[model samples]
Every structure is written in C-alpha cells, then in structure tokens.
Target: MSEADGIVYSDVKFTRTKRNTRGTTSSEAEPTYSEVRILKTHPSTELPGSQQHPVSNGGSKVTPERVVIVVLSALLAAAVIALGFTSLDNMHTKQSFQTLRDELEAVKRNLTERHCEVKSYNTVQQTSPQPPVVKENDPCLKCERGWEQDGRQCYYFSIDLLTWSESRDKCRQKGGDLVQIDSRDEQTFLELKVREKMKNDGDMFWIGLTDSEKEGTWLWVNGSPLNERLTFWSASGPDNWAVYNPDGEDCVMMGKKAGAPDLKCWFDEFCKYTRRSICEKPAETGHFTLQCV
Candidate 1:
C-alpha cells in the first residue's frame, strides 16, 4: 500500500510472509521479529564450600562395592575347589580298602580246596592189595633154603642141628624169631608144612615157645605170650623138671615125628647151634611176599 495510507502509523506492525520450500508449498505471512527482555540474573551462585569431585565414565573403572563383590566371589571359588579335592580323596581311600578285602577272600578259598585233596589221597592208600605164601619146593617161595611158606606160616627142616637154645638164637638174627603159632589157621598151616617138607631126621627143632624168663608162663620171643588154647604142649608137658635139673624147663622143641613134642631145659652156654630153624612173622598187610624197608 501507499506509504502508511496517508496517515503515519505510530505503533509498529509486523507482517509475516511465507515462501515455498523444496517439496512443500506455503501460503502464509512471515512472522515479524521482536526484542525480548531478560530478567537480571544474580552472579552465578557457586556451591558453598569445596568443589565436587569429578565423575569418570570409564567402563572398566573399579569401585569399592565392585571390589567387595569380586573378593567374595574369589572366596566362594576357593571353597568349592577344596570340597572337590576332599571328595576325591575319600573315594580313593574307599577303593583301596575294597581291593584288600577282595584279595583276602580269594586266599581263603584256595586254602579250603587244598585240605580236601589231601584227605582223598589217604583213603585210597588204605584199600590196596597183599602178597601170598608158597610151598618150599615151589619156585615162587621166598623162604630160607629148605624152608616152606604154608598159608601165613613158614617152616624149615634141619639136618646138622644143635641145642634148642642155639637154634633159637640163630633164627632171631635173620630178621625173624623161632616160629610162634597163634591162630588155628596158623597152627594148621605149620603142621601141614612140617608134614609135607621136614626131613625124616630124628632131631628136634626149637620153636618160638619159651618159659625161660618166667617159669610156667610161656612167652614168645616177640613178647606175645602163647594163649593156652593155641598151645601144642604135649599132655603133662613142660613139667617143672625133666631129663634136665630142677630148674624149670624153659624151652620147647617139636620133632617131625608125631608124639615127639616136648619141653626142654637147656643151658645158655649152648647158643651157637648150626641147625636150620624156622623164622616167622605175620605177613605185612599189603603185598606179604614183598619185604618192607
């Protein structure tokens, strides 16, 4: 409009105009600028005393609280490690004890088996075999020359003889004594051997029967006394005195001839007779023919 429309305006008037921007169109007036009054501000008021300490933004900065937490965590970790070691040690100790117990049980089982085997062997040895006796003339006979084994008994025939005491002593030296008959089977066996094998010579041979050590009490040299029931003493034989002096008759002789069994008294001075005499012993239980060491 013409300058102030012919009248001078005293108050300031503001006019606003708008302009189009790149993609926006505007149809408005521009705003007028005006002066703004600011109230007076007292000199900046400072904190009353010392300056505040600065704060840092470093991400890794350590604070007192954080240090305390870290220390506590370290203690926890140490406790955990100690507990683990204790458990492992306890397990190891238990394993060692179990191993020792197992070994002891195994040893006990082995010992029991060995004892059983020994008992079985002993039982078998008690039930084996034995040997037999043979006639003197038989090739299998192991008796002294001119001797015969009948059943369990052995007999001999004498040609050159001596006093009964001498013959008895000689028989004892060869691992035997003059024959002593104890059982019916033994007596029968001896009588048969004499009948079948003796020479017809009239000489009498000493038997094991003797009363020398104690008169009237017959005892075999082997220390077994003759039982009265098994004796071959002739009737009224062994009378305290005989063709010899009053010293009780101590020895007995049996002749090959029937009815010639007699008790004889002899002096110890005649103990060196060179007569064939019978030597007898109970056959050992097993393998009677084989000699035992």
Candidate 2:
C-alpha cells in the first residue's frame, strides 16, 4: 500500500514444468519467475484530488455528538421523574388542606348554635325602675313558640310546679329569670292570666319578689329594690306569716281571688313552697339571634 498515489499492490506466484512428448512425467523442472504489478485505490483513504472520507473503527469509538446526546437524554429523563413526584406531592397537600378547612367550618357552626345565649342568660341586667315601655304593636318583636309577648318582653308561664329556687333555675335554663313585675300593667296582665289558668282557689304562681335578705326591705330577683308606688300585697297582707313552718314567709306568690281588686294578688309565702311560676326575657333585637332552649 502506497500513501502518495493511494494505490495498493500485491504479489502472487505460479510454478510450471515441461512435459515429454510421450506424455511421460519428467523429474527435473525449471521454475520461471515474473514480476507483476497491479494498481488499486484504497477504499478508506482519500485520493490526492478527491474529497476526503471519514474513517470507521467498526462502531467501537464514541464521538463528541453521541456523548452529548446520551448525556442530554439521561438529564431529560431525570427531570421528568422529578416533575412527576412534585406534582403528586402538591395534589396530596391540596387534599389535606381542604379536609382541614371543612372540619374547621363544622366546629364553628356547632359553637355558634350551642353558645348563642349562654352569656346573656348568666349576666343579670340591673336598671332603675321606670314606666313600662310597651311595644306590643311593634313589627320587629319576636318570641319563642310557647311564650307570651307583651311590649318588649316575652313571658313563659310554666306549668311544672317547683320551689322558688328551683323555679328560678328552670327559668335560667330557658334563658330567662323569674318574671319581674315592674308596673301596674304588668301586674294586671299576670293577675288576669293567672285567674284564667287557675285550677282551684289554692292555685298560684310565684313572682320574683323576695324579702329574705332583710325583715322588711324587699328586693326583686335582679337585686333591685321594690318600688314603693307599685305595691301589690294582698288585701289581707304579706304578714310574713310563719304559722306553717319556722322559716317565715320571705318569697311571694300571686293567686286569683274571686272578687279581688286589680293588682291585688301578690302574697308573701315560704320559699320552699312548690308552685307554678312565670319567666321573662327581653325580645331578641336586630343585632343578634338567640336560640332559646
């Protein structure tokens, strides 16, 4: 193989022997040698005046282009895997957040329903005595289903018989206190209502007035002094009667009389005596809604 002319030459030899006329083989033979030169161009090398061709190494060698492509492919596959994992994690996070939000909303609603009037029922409102502010004809007044609405007040006449303390407890459970007769009209309203519902002459309803703190100075359940002008003691008297038991008559009750004058129904009695009683609360205003139990 010559690089200058891009030719490849090879030598091959052949041997010949002279035969006798009678076709007998001769033992002595003379070998003749001849020089033969054949010119061929190499398939892989470039000729002097022709274009150059690429060399091949049986596909064993790696090129720069192939190395770059392999590296890029591996990087792309890794990126795709990472992206899939990130997307899955985000989906789980979103689902967890939504579940927590729903739980919070349910708890908030339950709190609102159960605690609507708890504070109002526990705290007593102290106010000076004044003329009754009636709103019986107002459009915004609202009350519970079984309660009677008068002016801005709702009254619940309980049928269950309980002691004075027990009756106040029951009223507090219903989001109210015992009825506070603040005016002549209120006393008259209660008198007429009790008269109609009386089962017999002994039937009566307990009022909120009490004189247990002192012998003579009476106070309402809300710690307010009884009004001197609004006295409704029975015609017979409060008397602080103690004939039945030793505790004396400290609590008051209102009973129906066959021909008693209006607002003349109140009587001082033993606090341990069980009787039907009345409860009273202000009507719900526009600011907040109260769910009475």
Candidate 3:
C-alpha cells in the first residue's frame, strides 16, 4: 500500500516508570500519561474511477497574503533608494545656492568699494584749485568781453575821454594798462582804433609813453626809456606842443594817420587832456614772453 498522512484515534493501555524512594529505599512505579503522534496509511474514500492530481512539497506555494507582503517589501526598498538620491540632490542644490549667495555678496562689496573710490576722486577734484590752462598753439590769453585779441595781446579802446593818468587807472581797473607803442605794427593798429572813435578833427588817443618824469627823458610805465632812434614824431613834434598847457606836453599820442596834415606820428600832449585811450595786455590763455610789460 502507498503511504498516507493521517491522524488515528485509538485507546491504548498506558505504561508506568519504576522509581526508588530516597529514605525507605523501596522500589515503586510512577504513572505516566501523554498524547503521541504516529504515522499511518489510510485508504481513499473516493468513488471508483475518479481522477485526481497529486501534489508535492515543492508545489505547495505561498498564499495571497504572503505574496502581497513580498511585493510591498520590494516597493518599500525601491522607495528608500529613491529617497536617498533625492536627499543627496537636495543637499547638493543647497550647497550650490549657498555658493551663489556668497559670490553675489562679493560682487556687491566690490561695487561698493569702486563707488567709494569714484566719490573720493570727485571730492578731491572739487576741493583742489586748478591752475590756468595755457593754450597749446598760442602764447596769447583769451580776450575778455569788450577787448580785441591779436596775436599775443588783447586791446581795449575806450569811448569816454579821460585824462592820461585817469585813463591808465581805468585800464588797470579793467585788468590792463594804457597801450605802449612797442613797434610799428602796434602803432599802426592804435592809429586805426583811435581814428574809428575820433568822430572829428583834433580828437586824439593817449599812449602810455610819457616824459612827465623829466623835461626830455621819455619813459614807459614800466620805467623803461624809449629808444630815440625808434621815435615816430609828428611833423616837427615832441616839440612839446603847448596849446592846452604850458605845464608842457608830457603825454604822447598817435593822432590822425591821414588828412591835410599827416598825424600818424607821435606827439607830446598835456597829461591832463581828456582823450580816448587804448589798453593793451598779454593774452590770458598762454605764457607771455613780454613779462606783462
């Protein structure tokens, strides 16, 4: 017969174990009772000719609950791995953000420093006094209003007549002095200017040259004496004409350059005569070689 797995219920006599008493030294039997397991084969109660499939230990598989538990465990493990990667990515992103913040702060610091430097430079420029700028191409300064510029000199022709001394004071107030005829060019120019303002006969222009210091010794305002050889006398002039004052014709003038009597030459006249005057000075824009004489 084929072996079968089953439980059989049957009554059987129980056995007793023998034991010895410690004091009396008498032999005695101990009663024993227990439930036991036994292997047996049983006949099948199925109908004759019925078909059935045999199952082996290997074929006995896990239940639905156990399968569900295994699946859940696998999903949990995958989720844990994904979470670890996510945590690493988050940590890396935080590090990058911190680095960016630090770089931005550094840039801000640099900008602030640069701004401060610029401000400091501006402050210095504002506090310092700048020297006059000389024009590169010319040694003449720029003429102020009411003055005319020529080469390295600026000229001013006065309309209101004033005494020679008074005219010189006026010119000084205007940042200049009476025109000194240093050359023929200068003399010619003054003659033209005086002619333009004359308006009639006997009108004159006072120059800076004067012999007021002595009877016949002519000196410029700068204390420089005139070169007699270079003198431009009108007709028989520096005759110390005394029509206006016998105190003597001390001041010099360049009269009419044209007319029945030529007047383009120098003539001595009274220093007190009120007449249009010319002012001359070195140009303000560049180095003057004339020493402002």
Candidate topping TM-score: 2
Tens digit of lDDT per residue, candidate 1, span 51-97? 87778766687799999999999999999999999999999999899
Candidate 2, residues 84-200, lDDT tens digits: the string is: 999999999998998999899768655544544422322322231232243454334456779886656889998999999999999999999999999887787788888888888
Tens digits of per-residue lDDT for model 3, 68-100: 999999999999999999999999999799889
Model 1 root-mean-square deviation? 24.5
TM-score for candidate 2, please give it: 0.50
Candidate 1 Cα deviation (angstroms), residue 226: 1.7
- Candidate 2: which pairs clash? none
Q: Tell me the whole-model lDDT of each prediction, alpha carbons only.
A: 0.55, 0.78, 0.71
Those runs of model 2 whose alpha carbons end farther than 4 Å from true positions after fitting are 1-139, 285-293
Clash pairs, candidate 3, are 141-283, 141-284, 141-285
Better of 1 and 3 by lDDT: 3
Span of ten consecutive residues with least summed lDDT in model 1: 262-271
| TM-score order of candidates, top first | 2, 3, 1
Ten-residue region with minimum lDDT total, candidate 3: 284-293
